[model samples]
Target: MPENMPGRINPEHITIVLNQPRYPENIGSGARAMRNMGFYNLIVVDPENFDLEKVEKLSTHAARDVVEKIQIFDNLQKALSPFNYVVGTTARLGGQRQVNSPSVMAEKLIPISKENNIAIVFGREDRGLSNEDIRLCHGLVNIPTADFSSLNLAQAVMVICYELFNAGTKKKHDFNPRLASCYELNGMYKDLKDVLIKISYINPENPDYWMNYIRKFFTRMNLRAREVGIIRGLIRQVNWYGQKMYKDGLDHKKNQEADL
Candidate 1:
């Protein structure tokens, strides 16, 4: 193993997540890549074909430790719930998909990885992460490629892991404090969405489209747990006040009818 870096990032705090992978060999190779880069934490969500024998064959005896400790999840949301920071990998880019190069993303994660549990998520081989899947991520990373733009699953993992490993070898710096977990952030978003819908601030039929902007705005803030709690409390108060005013209006209408 190479000498440990003096940076703030703790390899143990960083996790590599594979979402709906189709092949066990890819999974094995991905694990091997992670092991080569000094990362051992691995999580797979809803794999289509998970043959341990094939996986072990590709991963070999060297990465046996990572393969043995792999964590499996039925859904992406559950897989990400415990993380404080989530970075999604994508090939396709367009509206709402703000992507950073692998090196830039790794540098951004250096400080955040000190106190937060970080998850680097890679999508399926055939199709990368969907719009909905991207919504769960705080940021996106794209590995620069030739015109082809497509990379093998393990290749992508290796590219990202290498960037992270290389970045961690730099000098240490002041680390960022602990941030809000996905569970807390998701709950706050749900409450805020409900309040916005109730007050007609967002279109109820297509609220997600509007909420996407809201999500991006808050994601930039890098909110802490206390900040999330404060926001949720405000949302609850707004919901209560809206309901009270509606009830008062109905009572006034009833009184007018009885007097008539």
Candidate 2:
């Protein structure tokens, strides 16, 4: 097995969006968390202080890559438009929009991200993302905390990235940064969805409901790309064998009829 980070595989594509961030140290700390959790992409959108040195200091040695490669964007939309899915992290809740717990949100994102470039946008430290900002996101990610919950910017990033990292492994040297791409997992889902549709287990039109359930169910399994490929290949083989059996049965029946 590969050296495990958080999810065993680094997320193929993930962008952390910080809008009007106040502190440089938080940025550094967040970057550090990203490196530790096997992430490299960091974006700062119109922050108060864009100090690379501060970020480097807070990021420590592990997160140097993230800080070095940081992308600066003029606004949130510009940063997020490229990604297919976005998850916003915030502390506030109770509005027209429904928010999910971090655990639930993480599971929901795992498979989707496997098939899409996923972005997690965080708002300002003092106030968190605005309602309009939250609306831009596909879903909300709320870390579990007390009634009066408060989390530092870096801490929040740490929590979310840690969720993606699979069980930590002791064999540090075997670590490979390559994660399953969105295309690969997309194919797996398509394969699984096809089987389910053919088996008449799912209503083809309203597959999202079932798919969401299945996505969460399978995400917890900590599946990797190679494992997904194995399953996909097996499914195809099973389908092929089933077709062969049916063809053979038809030929045998015709032969008997001719003899008769």
Per-candidate TM equals 0.94, 0.60
Cα lDDT of model 2 by residue, 2-118, tens digit? 336333323766777778899999999889888887888889999899887787888898877788888998887667766656788878668544678766776665545544577
**Tens digits of per-residue lDDT for model 1, 1-260:** 23355564578899999999999999999999999999999999999999999999999999999999999999999999999999999988777678999999998888898789999999999998988999999999999888798899999999999999888545556648899999999999999999999999999999999999999999999999999999999999999999999999999999999999
In candidate 2, which residue pairs get closer than 3 Å at backbone N, Cα or C atoms, i.e. clash?
A: 6-165, 6-166, 7-165, 7-166, 8-166, 114-182
lDDT, model 2, position 3: 32
Worst 10 residues of 1 by lDDT: 1-10
Model 1 misplaced regions, further than 4 Å: 1-8, 168-172
The TM-score obtained by model 2 is 0.60
Clashing pairs in model 1, backbone N/Cα/C closer than 3 A: none
lDDT, candidates in the order shown: 0.93, 0.74
Error (Å) of candidate 1 at residue 80 is: 0.3
- How far does residue 173 in candidate 1 sit from its true spot (Å)? 3.4
